[model samples]
Target: MSDQAQSTTMTPPAPSDFDGRRAFGRAARIRTPRTSHAVWSPPADRADPVSLLEEQATSRVPDLVPVRHGRMMVSPFTFYRGAALLMAADLATTPNSGLTVQLCGDAHLSNFGLFGSAERHLVFDINDFDETHPGPFEWDVKRLVASFEIAGRHRGFDDKDRRAIILAAGRAYRERMLAAAESTVLDAWYDHLDVDTMQAWLHDERQAERAAKRQVKTFDAVVAKALTKDSMQAFAKLVTTDGGQMRIIGDPPLIVPVEDLLDDTDIDDPEKAAREILASYRNTLFASARHPLSEYTYVHMARKVVGVGSVGTRAWIVLMRGRDELDPLFLQAKEAQASVLERFLEPCEYDNQGERVVRGQRLMQASSDIFLGWQRVRGEGRIERDFYVRQLHDWKGSLDAEKAVPRGTLLYAWICGETLARAHGRSGDRVEIAAYLGKSDAFEESIAAFAEAYADQNEADYQAFTAAVADGRLRAVHGL
Candidate 1:
C-alpha cells in the first residue's frame, strides 16, 4: 500500500453526540469550502491522459485494446466513460471535505440503471461497481455531475439548459442526503427507488400533453423491454444447439467459446476445465450443499468483451441448465482489478479485488443480485486472478441519455442524483454530509461550475486521445 493509503486507513473516532457530528461536518466547510470545488486547473506535472490509458492497456488483452479505444473514441462522453483513471488523478488535486463514503468510483450517468433486485422488482440504482472503493464523498458527486455536463454538450443543449440540469442533480443529492440524515437508521437502510416509483413520478410530474404522453410511453417501453432481458432471453439469443449438445455462439473479438480459445496443449480437456472453474465459483456463492446453484449443470463457457473501460479485461459468460435444456442460467464472471481510485485514495481492505467489488456493491446498493460472489482462478503459468460473478442479465437497462431531450435529461439527472445519494448515505455519515451541504445552493452551484470546467478538460483530453490514435501512439478499431 502507498503511504497515502496507510494514512487514510486510520480509524475515525466513534460517534458520541449527534450535534457534535453535525458540527464536525459544518467545520469541514472551513477546511474545504464548497466554492473551492469550482476550480479545475491542471497541474504542470500532471500525467498525460493518453499515457495513463496506455499504462492500463499493458495489463489487458492486446487484441481487444483497440476495441476499447474504439468505443472511447466515439465521443467525449464515451471517452469520459473510459477515463476514470484520468479523472481520479485530476480529482486527487482537488480540495475535499474529508467526508468519506463507499464511492461508486466511476459514478457517471450511464453507470446508474435499472436492474432486478433479489425480490424480482426492477429497482433504479448504481449498476456498476468495477471501480468502487472508499473515497471522499465529493469524488462521486463530481464524476456524476460532470457526466451530465459532458453528455449535455454532446446533445447540443444550450448553456442555460445544461446548467439547469446539473443543478437539478446536485440539489437532488443534497436534499436526499438531508432526508436520510433525519430518518431512523433502519428506515434509511431500507430506502430504495424502484422503476414503478419512477413511472409514477413521471405521471405526477409531467404536464398533460401530447409531448409528455409520448415521453412517458417511450419510458414505459424501455421498462417493458428490460423485463424481458433475463437468462431465458439470453438463452434464446446467444445459445444454440450444436449437434446433440448446447454451446455458446462464437463471435470472434466479442465472444469466443472456451474450446476455441484453448487448444489441447493449453488444457488437457476444455470441458473438464470449465466445469472445475464453475465448481470453484459455486463455492463462493453458497455454503449449503443443497443451494439452488447446485441444481444447475455447467454446459459451456465463453470469453466476452464487455463495457467501455472494461473491454480488454477477461470477462466470461458461463451457460448452465437446471433440470432440462430449456431451463437455462447464464452467469458472468468478470476479472476484478485494483480500483482506479486505489492509487489516489486508500487501498481496499479486502485482499481479493473481486471480494472488494462484491463487498462494496453489497454495501452501496439497497439490494443486489443473489449470485453476486467472488473467487480466485489460476491461469497458465499459475497466474492467479480475482473475478466476481453474477447473473449475466436480470432486467438490466439504462436510460438512453444520448437520445434524451433537455427536460428528460434533467429529470434523469435528478433520479441518478437521488439514487447516488442513497448509496452514499448507506455507508457514510449521513448527518455530517447533510450538515456540510446545509440549506444552500452554494454547494450545488459550485458543483455545476466545476462540472462545466471539467467538461472542458475532458474535451481537451479527448482531443489529445484522438491525436494519439491518429499518430499511431494508440490503435483504435472504430464501430465495435
Candidate 2:
C-alpha cells in the first residue's frame, strides 16, 4: 500500500461475532438510554458562545475576522453554521452511544453537497472537513438534523413541516446504518451515493407521493450545473488577462493578488517564494515517476476569503498553467487549524493540522479530490502554518437552503442522512452503531426533539452575537 494509504487507513478487524457487537451496542443503552439523547439544556457553567468566537478570532487574519462575523450574522441558520465551536462544547454535555466515527465535525446541512468523484461522476457527500475528528457518531447527526430545523424556521416553514423534515433525516440515518450492518464489510466500504442513484431515489419519492415533477427537474438542473462547475469554469470566472499575462483578478478583501499583498512586505522575491511553497506542496501529492500535478507550472496566486466558518484563517488560490494559459488549474491552499472538537475530545493524531483534515476526509469520504495534499509554509512574519491543498472547484454544487421548498428540503435531508451514515459506517463499527440505533424509532425521535431544542438555543446565541456586534464588541461589515 502507498504511504498515504497506510497512514490514513483505519479498517476495523473482521467481525468474529456480529451478535456480540450488537449486544455491546444494546448494552450501551443501559449506560446511555436512547431517550436521553433528547436532552439539550446548557450546563450552569457553560462558556459564553460569543466569548469563544472572540478567542478563535485571535488566531485568524484580523481584517477578515469581521467578514466571518458578518456572514454569520445573516441569520440564525448562518450563525449556527459558524458556531461549531460553541456547539461542540454543548454536545460534550450530552449522552453518547460511545460508537465512534470519523465525523464531518461541522456536518451542518450546508456542509453536505455535490462534488465530482475521481471517475468524473457527480456524487453527494460531506464537503467540509474543517473540524473533522473522531467522536460520538450522533454528534454529526444532531448537527445535521438541527441545521434543517434552524433552516426550516428561517424559511417560515410551519412547526409540523419542520418536525417532519427533521424526522426524515433522523429516520434515514437509522435505516441506513441498519442496512450497512447487514451488508458485508467490503460492501459497506464500497458504498457511495452517485448522482444517478440520487436521481432514482428522488424519482421513487415522487412516484410514491405523486408529487410534482418539478423536483425531478430541479435535480436534473442541479446535476447539469454541477457538471459545468469544473476548473475550466472557475478559470473563466476568476482569471483575467493583462498585457497577455493571465492573472487572478483583484477584488480587494475577497480576492487580493499576491503582488498587491507583497508590495511593502519583507519578502524579497515574492514569485520565487510562491514557487518554492508550491514545490513543497507538490512533494506531498502522490509521487510517482511523474505526478499529475508536475504537468502544471505555477503562474499566479491570490489570497481569497471563502466560506462562512473558514473566512478568517488564511486561504489562497494558486493558479497553475498546464500546456498553456487555456489549460489552467486552480488550487486552493486553505489553512488548517486544530479542530473545534479537539478541546472537547482527545487531541488529533496527526501533528500537522492539515494532515489531520486530509486524513479524516479520506476516511469518511468515499471519493476525494485527486489534488488533495497538505504542506506547512512559513509566511509574512516567518511563522509556519499548515494548509491542505485541493482543486478550487471540481464540479461542485450545493442546495441553497433559503430557496428550497419544503418537499425539496425534506428529500435533501433524507439524502444527507444516508450520506452521513455511509461515511460513519466506513470508519466506525457498522454493526455496533446499527445495533445501538435498533429497528425502533426511539433514537430518531429523540434526535428530532434535540434538533428542535438546539434550534432554540441557536437563536438565543445568535441574538447575543448580534448584540456584541451592535455594541462594538465585535466588528462586522455587512453584505459582503
Candidate 3:
C-alpha cells in the first residue's frame, strides 16, 4: 500500500461515546464461575484515540508545574507516545469482563523488567503503570499482543513470523492464566521470576540458539552495571559546577534543576522546601510496609529527564546519604496524574493518583520496590497531582530492544504472559476466560491481525510527530 493511502486507511476510530458492555461483547465473550460480571459502558465518543490523548494530557497539565509552555508542543508522535494512558482509555471502553484487578495499562514488552523485590530478589515483571486502573484483563493482553506485532515489524520480521510470535504470546497467556486460576491465591501471588529461575527455565527448554543465550548474558551484564557503586558515580557525572554550586544539567522540561523550577516561590529556602517535600514523601514510604529509605538521610534533589515517552514530564531524582559517601540511596519521585484509563473508568475514590499507581503496581507485580509510595503536592493555586517515589536503581534492569533477537522476543512474551496471568488471577478466579481462550490458536490469530493494524497506526502517528518537529511546532531535544 502506498504510504499516503495507508495513512488515510489507518486513521483510528474517532472518539465517540461507547457502551462498554457492548464493546466487551464485540471483543470477547465473558465467562465467569457464576453469572458473567456486569460490564460498565463508557461513552462511544470518548474512545477516539486523538480525543482521549488530548483529555489525558489536559488533566495532567495542572499537576505538571515544573516546565510549562513548550513542553506541550512536541511532535504528534511524541505526544501520542506520551499519551499511552489515552490508548488505555480507548482499550478499556472496548468490550471486556467487568472482572477487573489493577492493570498495567501499558503492558508493552518494554514495560516488563527486573527490579529488587521486597525479598531482596531481582524479580522480573511489569515495571511501568502510569496508566494503571481497574479494567478488563483482556485490555492488557490485547495491548501487549499489539505491541509485539508493532515491535516485530520494526525489526523487519515477516508477517508469518510476526503472527507466530503473537500466537505464542497469546497461547502462553491463556495457558498460564489457567494454571494460575488453579493455584492458591497466596501461591499465585508469590510466584515470581528471578534471574536464577529464568536461567533454569531456559536451561530446561534446551534451546540451542546462541543468540537467545547471548541476550540472557547481556541482561545479566546490564544488571551488574547498574548494581555497582561505580555506575551510580557515573550518573553523578551529569552533576557539574554552576556558579560554584553543584547542579545537574538543566534543559527545560527534560532536565530542570529543582531550584530553577521552584523559583519565585514563598519557601525562601529551596533546600529547606525540598527537605520538607522529602519528609512528606518519606511518610508515604513508611505507610507502604516497605522501607528502602529507612537507612538513608535526604541529602539533595535534582530534576531528572527520563524515558522516551516520559521525557518532557516532571520527574526528579533525589539523592540520600547513609552511613557515609559510599553508602547512598537514589529515589525517583515521578509526577503522576489520572491515567488514560480514568476517563473511561468509573471515577476512583482515592484522592491520590500516585497512590493509585503504587497500589496497582503492588497488586499486579509478584514483587515490587520497597520504597514505592504516593505523595500529593499542590503545585499552583489549588492544582494537585500525585507523585510516586521509588528507589532509582535497586538492582533494576531491562534488555536493550535493539539487540533482542526473535527467540529473545518469544521468551520475553512468554514471561509477560505468565506475569499477566498472575496479575489477573488476583481479582477474579473465573477459569472461563482461560477456557474461552482455549488451547486453540484462534485468539492468537485475532491478536496478530489487531497488532498489524495498530502498528500501522503507530507508524503513521510517528511520522506525523516527526513532521511536527520539522515544522517547529514543538521543541524537542533528543538523545539526552
Candidate 4:
C-alpha cells in the first residue's frame, strides 16, 4: 500500500481481480493440515554430506578450505551451523505448503539478533542473508525450528525440554501470522521489533523494583553495552596505536590483513581494490544511504574470517575515516554465492549474486542497513566473487546458544518464530498462508514432528562426517 493510494480516494479492486478471502479459501482447499505434516524420508541414494561439502569447496578459496572443515569438526551443532547447503539439498525433497516468500535461506537460531535500523533504533530480525532467495516460506521455518532441536541436543537438553522449545517456536509462528493476517497492510508495514520490546524481557523488573530501581538502571546499561559495539569499539579491539600510528593487528588464518594474505611479490594494492569495490557498492545504495558514505575515505582492508557456515569465503573488513580520528566507520564486505534454495526452485531473476542477497534482505526486513549494497571483485586468478557491504558492527549482538538455559532458549525460540512470521508476512500472501495454517496446533505439531525427525537425520549425518574425519578422507584443523 503506497502513501499515494492511501491519501487519495481510491476504488477497491474487483473481487475477481483481488480478494483476500477467496485467495485464502483457495489455498486452504489445496493444502490441508495433513499435507503440511510433511513426511521426512530420505531416498536410498541421498547425496553424501561430505561429497556435497567437497563439491562446494570447488568454488571457495582453496587455502582457507581446511579452516572451514576444522570449524565443522568441533561439534554436531557446529557441523549443522556450517551445512546450510547440505540441509537445503535434503529439504528439497520434503513436501511443502506451496507458500513462497523471500527466505533467509539460512534461518538458524544464531542468525536472529539485534542490530541498529536506519532509524537508529535497535531491532531484532534475521541478520544473515548470504543465501536468501524466493522460496517456500516453510523452508525458513523448517531451518529455524530444526536448528533449535539441534541446539537443544548440543546443550544436552532432554526430549521434553526440546519438544517444549520447538513447539513454542511453532506456535509463535502460527499466532503471529494469524495476527498479521488480521492486521491492515499499513499496520503490518509499520510493525517492527523495537528495543523497548526487548528491554521488557531483558530486565528483571521485580528485582529492580526491590533494589530501589538500581537494577532498573541496568536496563539502560544493557542497551548502552549493545550500542557501544560500533566501529570505535571494533577499532579499540582490532587496531593498535604503535609508535603514534594505528594499524590493524594480524592474526593468521582468522584475522590476517589483506597484505598478509597476498604473496610478497604480488603487484596489486589492496587499498586500490577496496576503493574500486566501494565505488561499485556506492552505486548500488539509494541516494539517502550513498550520500552519507561520500564523507568517508577508505583506510585499510583486512581479510576477516566469519561465521560457522561462512568460513573459507572471501570476507573482508574495510576501515574508513571521516571528520577526524574519532569518526571511524567499519564496513564488512562478505562473499555471496548462489542461493542454496536456488537449485531447488526457478532460476534467480538477478544477475549479480550479491544483489540477490541485498534484495532478499531488504524485502524480508522491516528496516535494513542504510549502507547495505553489493559489488563484485576479481581476485588473483581473475576469479570473480560477489559481496554485499554493511556496517560491520552497528549495535550487533548475537545470543550465545551455549549459554542459553532451557527456559531462555524457549523464550528466544518464541521470539525467533514471531520474527520469522513478520518477515514472511512482509514478502508473501499472509492472508492465504495464514488461512493454510488455520486455527489449530495440528500444523504446528506436525512441523515439530518433522523437526525431530530431521534432527535424527542430522545427527546420523554428523556421525558420517566424523567417520570421514577419523579415516583421514577430509582434513580437520581443530581449535581454530
Candidate 5:
C-alpha cells in the first residue's frame, strides 16, 4: 500500500471495539512455545564466530582489539560476554514471539549489578547499555540465562547444577513478569530491588541476631564504597603528579591519554575540545542535571579501556573538581554504535546512537544517573563519533565471582531475573507477556534447554577463538 492509502486507513479507526486485552489476545496467535524456544540447533551455514568478532573490531580502536581477544580467551564465561555480536547474529534466526521491548543487547551474568539510584540508594539493575535497543525481549532473557550456563562451566559445575541455575533464572523472570502483570501501573513503576529492601527480605532467613546485624553492616559498607569512589579514585588510579604538572600515567595499550592518541591534531587544544564537547553533553541532560555541572571544572581526561567486550571501544574518563580540592567527580564518555539487533529488527527510533542508549536506559531502569547525557564528536575530516556520558562510578560495585557459592548464585540469579523483568515491564506489555508465559512453566523450561544447547555452542566458539589466537590470526595479550 502507498503512504497515502495507509494514512486513510488510520483516519477511520473503527475496527470493531479494539482494546489492550484484545490486542494482547491477538499477539498470542503468533509464536508458540514448542516452536519458539524448545528446538535449538546451529545452522550448517552459521557464520564463523571469529569472523563476527573481526567485523566488530573494524569499528574499534586497532591496538585495543588484542586486549578484547585476551579477555575473551580467559574462559568460556568471558568469551560469552565478549561474543554478544555472535550471539545476536544467531538469535536473529531463532523464533521470536513478535513482541518488542528495550533490550539489553548484551545481557549476561556480569552485566547485571549494583549502582546508586538517583536517590543515593544502592539499586540492582542492568548496568550496561552500549547496545540497548528495541527488540524481542526474549533475546535479553536468552542471553542472560545462557550466561549462567556458560559461567557454570568455569566454576566446574556439573550439567545438573548448570541446568538448575538456568531454570532458576528463567523461573524468576516468569514469576516476576506475572507479578508485574497483576500489579497496578504505579506499583510496577515503583518496583525495584534496592539494597535496604533486599536486606530486609533476607532477614527472615537469618539465624543469629548479631551475625545478621554484621551481615547488614557489611552490605552497608559495600554500598557506601561506591559513594567514596569518585574523581579522586580515578585521579589516584589513572594519574599522578610528576615533574611539575599532573598527567595521566600511561598504562601501555590500555590507558592511553587522548593527547597521545591524536598528536598535534585538533585535539592539541585539549582544554578547548573538552569545553566544547562537554557543552554538547550538558545540553543533552535535563535542565536541573545540567546546572549542577557548572559547579565543577574539567581537570583531565584519559582513554581508559574497560570490560571484556568493551575493551576496544573508545572510552574516556574525565575528572572534574568542584568547590574544594576534596570535591571531585569522575565522568565516563564511551563510544556508541548501532545495536547488534539493528540488522534483524527495525531501525532504532533515535538517529544518534548515544541518545538511543540514554533514552532506552531511562525507559528500562527504575532510576537513572542524574548526569546521564550524550555528545556528538566532530573532528577534522569526517572524524565523527557518538558518545554517552555518566559518572564513572557512583557507589557502584558488582558481585564478584569469587563469592558465587551455590546458594549465592541462586540468589544472584533471582536478583538478575527480577531486575530484568522490571526493565521489560516498564517498556513492554506485561499483561501480554504474562499471558503468553501462562500457568505452565513450558516457556521457562524451553529457555533453560536453549541455554544448555547454546552453552555447548559457546564452548565450540571458544575453541575456535583460541585456535585463531594460537595460529597468530588473532593477537591476544594474556593477563592485564
Candidate 6:
C-alpha cells in the first residue's frame, strides 16, 4: 500500500463520550472558576499564521486531498483562514470556566450564508459542517468572535472597532441563548432569518445601520442571480466540444474531470464505473412528492473543484433536468470523512461519517437540507466515508466582510450569536450558561483576546505552508 493509503487505514483516536448535559457540565466547570480568572494567555513567540496553516494542512485526514489542494492555493492568508478546525482543537485545551454548547465546528465568518428553505424562502444561517460535532457552545462563539477579529484586521479595521465587533457578538450570543432557552423548542426549531425578517429586525433596532441592511439586500440579489438556471449557462460556456463531446476544461487538481479519478475508463465507454456511480446516486434521491428533486432527471455529472480547503477533495456536481431546459436541479456530492470535531466528540452509533454530519447538522441547525442523507460507496479497500447531498446552489450567498462597515459587522455578529444560542439552547445546561454570561462584557473581551492570539497562530501556519511548498515537501496545483 502507498504511504497515504496506509495512513488512511490506521484509525485515529476516538473522541470522548460525554453526553450533551455532561459535556456542558465539563465546560461549565472550566468557565465558572475562570469567571474571575484572567484571559487565557497565548503562546509567547507565537508561530506566524502561514506556518500554523501549513502545520494544520499536514494533519488533514487522508481522504480529502482534492479539497486540501484548493484550500492551499487560495493564498497564505486564505489557507491560514481555513485552518479553524486546527484552532478549535487547540482552544479546547485552554483553561476554561466550563462554558459550552453544541458548536458549529467551523464558525468562521464566511461559513454563514443564505440558502433556500422548504418554503422556498431564502434564509440565512451557518452553511458548512465538515467539522461539526457536539462540543462546548463557547468554542463556536470563540471561533466566530476570533474570526471577526482576524477578518476585521484583514479589512484594516482599527483595534477598537474590532474589539467592539467581538463584544457585540458575545452580547448577542449570550442574549440569544437566554431568549431561546425561554422559547418553546418547536418555536426555536421553526425560527429562521428570511430576508424580510432580517430587514425588519435591523430596522426595528433603529441602530443607524441602513447601509448594512442595504448591503444584505444587495447580497441577496447577487446570490439569486448567481444561482439561477441562466447563470448555469455561464458554467456551460466553460465547456467545449472535444471530438464532438462536451467536456469541462481540465485544470488538474482543481477542475479534474470525473474520468480522471476512475481507472480504465475509455472515452468510448458509456457505462464506465464513474458513470455507474452517478447512476447509483439517483437511488439516494429523496422520494418523489416529498422532495422537489423528484422532478429532475439525471443529465450529467462532473468532478467540481470547490472551497479553498476542499479544492482537492472528490466533489461532484450532479445535474438533473426537469420538464424543460430552463428547469434544472444540481446536487453536490462531496466526500465526507471523520471530522476533526470527531477527535473531540464521542463515537456515534451510525457507521457512516456522512450520516454523522447529517445528524449533527439536523440536530444543530433549525432546519437542514431536505435531501440530506448519507451512503457508502466502494472506495480503495472498501473504505467507508460519508456523503451529504444538498441543492447545488439555490440563492446561496454571503457578506463580503472585507468591504462591510462596522454596522454590518455588528449585525452579522448578532445573527451569529443568536444562531449559536439557539443551538446551545438545545443542550442541557442553558440555565447555567445563561447565568454565567450574565449580561456582562467580560466574556466578550476574553474571546477577543483568544481570537487575536489564534489569528496569529493562523498566520504562522500559513507561512509554514508556503515554506513547505517552497522546500518541495508538499505539491500544489495552482491557478485553477
Give the clash total for candidate 1: 0
Candidate 6 lDDT over residue span 1-480, tens digit each:
112111111121222322343344334444344343224454554335444445555534343443565455565446644676566556545554444345667787788877766566767778887777666566677778877877777777887888788877887887876665455656655666676677566556575444455755665565566455332563464455567554556765445566665651122332254345555544654563355555656655666767765544456666566775456556677777666555545555468767666776777666677766665556555544457676676667777765777767777877877766776666434655665565566666667777777767666666666677677766665555
lDDT of 6 at 274: 38
> Each prediction's TM-score against the native?
0.95, 0.95, 0.79, 0.90, 0.90, 0.79
Measured by lDDT, the strongest candidate is: 1
Q: Roughly what TM-score does model 1 have, to 2 decimal places?
A: 0.95
Clashes of 6: 47
Which 10-residue span in candidate 5 carries the lowest summed lDDT?
A: 1-10
Candidate 3 stretches with Cα past 4 Å from truth are 1-83, 209-213, 229-253, 264-270, 286-294, 430-432, 470-475
Q: List the residue pairs that clash in candidate 2.
A: none
| Candidate 1 per-residue C-alpha lDDT over 90-129 given as tens digits, one digit per residue, 9 for 90 to 100 | 9988887789999999999999998999888999999999
Deviation of model 3 at 52, angstroms: 5.3
Q: Which model, 1 or 2, shows the larger TM-score?
A: 1
lDDT of 2 by residue, 48-135 (tens): 9999999999989888999999999999999998999999888887876677889899999999889988888889999999899988
Candidate achieving higher TM-score, 4 or 6:
4
Summed backbone clashes in each candidate are 0, 0, 17, 0, 2, 47
The lDDT values for all models are 0.88, 0.88, 0.62, 0.80, 0.79, 0.61
Best by TM-score: 1
What local lDDT score does residue 242 receive in model 6, on the 0 to 100 scale? 68
lDDT of 1 at 412: 84
lDDT by residue for model 3 over 128-243, one digit each (tens)? 98878776676787778877777777677787777778877877887887676456656766766787787666665565563366666766686685455332563475455567
Candidate 6 stretches greater than 4 Å from native: 1-31, 34-38, 41-77, 96-101, 203-205, 209-253, 264-295, 427-429
Per-residue lDDT of 1-480 in model 5, one digit per residue for the tens? 111111111121132333564345345535334336865688788899989999999988887899899988988888888998898888877776656678988989888878888887888899998889887778899999998888887888777777778888988998998898888778988899887787676565653442355454555666677566656776677667667556678876777776777762334466678778887688888774547897988877788889999888888888777886567778899989888877767778898999999998999999999899998887666577888999987767776664455555666787799889999989876776776676677877999988889999999999999999999999998886
Model 5 scores a C-alpha lDDT of 0.79
- Those runs of model 4 whose alpha carbons end farther than 4 Å from true positions after fitting are 1-38, 201-224, 242-245, 264-267, 288-290
